[model samples]
Target: MKKKLLNQPTFLLGTIITSIMLLMTFIGFFYTPYDPTQMDNSNKLAGCSLEHIMGCDNFGRDIFSRVLQGMGNTFLIAVATVTIGVVCGILLGAFTGYFGGWIDEVIMRIIDVIFAFPSILLALVFVSIFGTGKYNVVFALGIAFIPSFARIVRSEFIKYKDMDYVKSARLAGVSDLRIMFVHILPNTMTVLLSSIMIGFNNAVLSEAGMSYLGIGVQPPDASLGSMLSEAQSYLFSAPNYAIFPGVMIILLVLGFSLMADGLKSR
Candidate 1:
């Protein structure tokens, strides 16, 4: 059954695309065809050639190298944001759901308030206050994402907290923490995993949007969003500047979406 599900076209394609991007990100840590940050005005806006496969940006930085480096930056921010959201969100949600009292009401109300604002707007506010940087972007996006993850985890915990195994664990004199973390949490893994993938996809997109708006990773650090923002003016003359990064962002998001769908199907 597992093998059959893995063989499904959506799952296979997602895995392949995600693996390629992951490989690119890993390789980018050690090497790129040229220095991604180095500028060469003499070769600025050059088209694809044997020397520079993805061509050059207006600043003459190798687009291929920049894209490779940007992959690492983008993935790093997404992973960090998702990690923060999952850890903090799950703990808060599980406690609220399992306890279910004034505590739950208070927490849910706070979450509701957060949800009242669109995520991008919240992110913009955070960036504006905290100032623009890579870590700031991660922090902003992670905080903005907390409400959704918390809601999902809270629902999952509510469903599983009353299950037989959980009750048995409680009757066995197990601590509430133990029941929540050990007994209840494992049962929620399917939903949690699905939420995690979706959160990661959203994180990536949010970071890109923030960066494009000039509130994300700043200059000299290549990010897919910043790359697109920079290439906008050069759209007509150096279309590859916009094209490569734009395609990369699409592929990244598509890979995660397909993976989430595949997992949910199982």
Candidate 2:
């Protein structure tokens, strides 16, 4: 099963793309052709050349460097957001599903209330209230994404709570915590893993949208969304400024989407 999964076409393709993006992000820590934020008015809007492989933006900052740096920021926010969502969702879902009765009803009702608002809208509200920054955006998106993961996890836990293995663990004097964490959690992960990937994709998109709207990672730090936002004015004059960042966003989302699909197929 593991070998087949590793060999799956979609999985392999997604892995390759994701790996390349990660490599670019890692490389940004050490080197880029030029400083992404350094502006050289003399070279403004220059076309791709040996010196500037991806060309220069209107501010004359190297597009390649900005894109690489943006990749790192996007990855960080998305990973952090998904981590918060998954952890909180799993804990709440496990407790509610295992305990059942009033606890389930109350927790699920709360989740439903959160679900009433669209994720983006909810995130926007959070950003508006907490103000803007990378961590703020992560927190906002993480809270917004919790309901979806909670519902998925709740269903999975409910499905397994009464299963033979779980019952066996219960009968064998295993504590509820142990059964839920040690046994049920592992089984639930197969499905949860796919959801996690999808959530990560959504998180990246959400962060980009928030940043584009001016509530995400602020200036001095680059993000694909912020780059696109800044380049909007120079679209006709220097299309490469927007083009590279747009492509990076699409590729990043595509990689996660494909990986989710592959994991689901497993």
lDDT values, one for every candidate: 0.89, 0.89
Q: How does candidate 2 fare on TM-score?
A: 0.97
Query: What is the alpha-carbon lDDT of model 1 when measured against the actual structure?
Result: 0.89
lDDT of 2 by residue, 1-266 (tens): 87787799998899889888888889987887778899999999998889887789888889999998888898899999999999999999999888899989998999899889987788788878888788888888888888888888889999999999899999999999999999899998879999999999988888888888888889878999999999999899888888999999999888878888998987
The residue pairs that clash in candidate 2, if any, are none
Displacement of residue 60 (Cα, Å) in model 2 is 0.8
lDDT by residue for model 1 (1-266), tens: 76986788898898889989899989998999899999999889999899998999988999999999998999999999999889889988999999999999999999899889988898888878978799888887888888888999899999888888888889999999989898888888888887898888888888888889888888898999999999999999999989999999999988888888898888
When superposed on Cα atoms, how far off is each prediction in RMSD? 1.1, 1.1
TM values, all candidates: 0.97, 0.97
lDDT of 2 at 33: 76
